[model samples]
Target: MITEARQPPGGGIGIAVRDLKVAYGGTRVLHGVSLDFAPGSFTALLGSSGCGKTTLLRALSGFVPVESGSILLGGEDIARLPPEKRGMAMVFQSYALWPHMSVHQNIGYGLKLRGASRAEIDAKVTSVLSILGLAGYESRKVTALSGGQRQRVALGRALAVDPPVLLLDEPLSNLDAKIRLAMRHELKSLHRRLGLTAIHVTHDQEEAMTMADEIVILDAGRVLQKGSPEEVYRAPNSPFVAAFLGADNVIAGEARLDGEALAIRLPNGGETRMPAARRVEGDCIIHFRANAVHFGAGSTRAGLRLAGRITQSSYPGGVYRYEVETPAGRFLVDDERRANPGEAIELLIPTEEMHVFPAGMPSA
Candidate 1:
């Protein structure tokens, strides 16, 4: 069984979802999911499409009704609160901007609806435009702006309300790759500058890993893992998390607890000890990134090494991706130098960097 993390920080208007569950009438979606978002911290809800990440986000905003659970906002159960009453704002993938409203009007619309005076709305909108770097263009219609500018306007609108929490649903998806990367840094900076607690939902692994202080990886409506970006990436608890986090190379087989050491039996009738302190059992898989596995022209490690014949090679951009057939199995090897097809080579994975997971174990 997977154990919960213990290093939770306290005191924040940030959300804590305990035993949270949601479903569509008869079919269950989220399963007893729990997560914490600290005030002024950025958290990403990451998973493949249709994985209930959006549902979970909506639940946090009180848009989706929770069947059971407590959405503790500053330790108060606000699960039953209406979406508008929660004092949180969200930005959608489409920007969700009103085409008919000018940038300024759209930004100040929220405050206006809340009965702010005309002068107050104008003042808030002016400050927001300046803060979001959209100054001198507040009068422009939404349709006249470029994608990045429109994104900024959307952000300005969200921030104009000064909500304690900000929910971003794939806010960078529509931008080009370069623009997206730039915006990611901007968002991080904005978070730090404003000290706003933000929950971002994204399917892009790099985006989530880059922007979030912590990540909650979800799959099939359940959280597979949650940890600091490095913790989840370096020490994933399952094969699924490893694979999901881009641990593509695999040497899966059987293993047993031989006293304190795990004796992993190789496919070619060889066995290796993974030292003591291994927890998982039964069939297990060890995954290393393709970049982690390399083609060594000369073998340095003597025993317990893989000797494979490189059968395919492709120059994908600056790096070489190679397919190696070994005595144990086939593995993808990524190298900087080109290896001629059908060349025999040795691939080494530093034991310390190898991520291992027990078979048949479900992700969180």
Candidate 2:
């Protein structure tokens, strides 16, 4: 556990990005992106590759030149400042540690560059090593460390500077799955303990959901949604957002107003009514996760009922996953019960788990 004496100072600074734009040659990577990071909050920039998530992070760190707009740190525009002068530290996706440097040297390189004395560097490195659970490995060369250790060294280097904000660019992407899970807890704990504002860029949805206080999802260089993990997952505003967030079972239907409820008529002559939030009275798309489906129609809930034939079955661990073929489309369903291929099954999807969006929306 890190003590108060070892905690980095001058944290809890807020950041605001306004109309930020960046381009690579003729292609604009960030299309007028704007967002905010509350003081001491951890925000994750999440999107598929080419969505400009990394570009946004790099722009904030001053690694990429901004084409237009401002990046405000603590209410001061730092968009024009150089990376070092921006008062932020970044942990790269490659770890970016010097191969010849020892752990202590790697962690203290920033301080040494700033003309700190040998004694001062030693003390700071020692404290940072302890905080990173690497106190005894100070003299070990970075090249000799394991992937997880190397990650810690990279993080330690950033933390040693004690900047008010930290930028992480998928720092755990290279670690093995088990180590990655463990590091997630460590990083979250460290962020809370240090109270530093953090902006993390990641393509992994689970990582963003688990580690971030807020999730900013971007698509095609545009902001799609910004909310807590649950908010975005539960109430996606568009078909693209819903599909990207793992609502993979999509069905096409036509919706009509049925009293205060919305009735969806499927091509297979099946109809279901769900409480309507938005008055979508036309062709629409409905999406739900595999786990949201049950293997029976006995439930007395108001939801979609689909008759499907199991085309494939596999066990990926705790549950059985089945690919069900229906008249509309093939859908993936997860359940604990074992059902063989070619077996007919009834899919029951609760109304609360269904996400309805108008047709012709982007599903990619």
Candidate 3:
């Protein structure tokens, strides 16, 4: 465990993890994952299932032991501290409320364990319920409430302790689509109003992008990228991040290094000039989102373009999705104007909004 430096005359409480590693038996799950959270900032740790996000959160909460590393809380090393001593609260995905208890009792359970007076607990519970918009249903059993209500009750319980940091483990996964979106807005507003430092774990990219100030993208137990939602979305550093963050149409091509640009040789022997990729290689893949390309404008004159025929079409809502067969490979494109199948279309590729990376990158 690392012994952090003492305050040199001033003080503040923030959380930092250094060279964190965790393993299950023989196989390692996390490898040297490190992150820093400001005292009043909200960040989200996002990755697919089994990517070790939950494992890392559990380790921070003191529910799991770290194989090798240190967790620094309040400017002191706390890998050895017990859960209660860490002064943190967690809201799980399953709404883990006691079914037999009333909403009031559920919200007051943490204070009771901390040994607060009867009147103190009552006041705190009433205040919290009012804050959570659950005042009228305090006497009602937890089982009688809706899913969103239960979720709010769970949140109220976590907030009653007034921990400096909040850790949420996929707290919106179980709700319906509309409720989930509403909860996202509520959580965002509540976090801003309360000024709570929070780290939320989620696999949903949209949830992370919409709710978090900074997004930490993880894969296979390692943090792949950490930045604002716009940064990660517009300028992805790796192929894995680009693909995992959303549906990206990736193409395999041959890249040759130019002065500050790259000449890409398409599979059909066509060539296009693009910005210099990270690695100069014989083969690589470039990904663009479906909405990034414009349809039916002939070969893109300024940037790269491939000849493709619209093979299939599907309407999800406002826009139509088209599967186009291109020379490099197939690609999914979104067209606002609908068209029948077997129509010829040109995918206009913009030079600025394209991503190029090494091939054979692993998937989530």
Which is the leading candidate under TM-score?
Answer: 2
* Quality of model 1 by C-alpha lDDT: 0.81
Q: List ranges where model 2 is wrong by over 4 Å.
A: 1-9, 258-260
- Candidate 1 segments whose C-alpha is farther than 4 A from its true place: 1-12, 258-260, 269-271, 275-277, 296-304, 317-319, 362-364
Candidate scoring better on TM-score of 1 and 3: 3
Q: Give per-model CA RMSD.
A: 6.1, 1.9, 6.1
lDDT of 2 by residue, 105-178 (tens): 89999999989999999998988888888888899999999998899999999988888899999999999999
In candidate 3 the C-alpha lDDT for residue 40 amounts to: 74
TM-score each candidate. 0.90, 0.95, 0.91
Residues 1-364, model 3: lDDT tens digits? 1112121211124789998998888788989999988877789999989999999899899888788889999788888788888877899899899998999899889999999998998888877777677776779999999988899899989988777788999999999899899889888877776677889999999999999999998888898999999999988888788878763777778888888888887787656787775656778787777677757474434666667888999999988988888776777788788778898877766766678776776643
lDDT of each: 0.81, 0.89, 0.82
Between candidates 1 and 2, the one scoring higher on lDDT is: 2
Show model 3 residue runs off by greater than 4 Å.
1-13, 277-281, 296-301, 360-364
**Residue range 1-364, candidate 1, lDDT tens digits:** 1012221222226788898999978788888888988888899999989889999988988888999988988788889999988888899889999999999889989999899999998887877777677777878999999999999888888888888889999999999999899899888877777778999999999999999999998988888889999988988877778878888677767778878777776676545676633575778777767667776556454224677899999888878999889876787778888779888787766554577677666533
Instruction: State model 2's lDDT.
Output: 0.89
Cα deviation of 127 in candidate 2 (Å)? Answer: 1.0
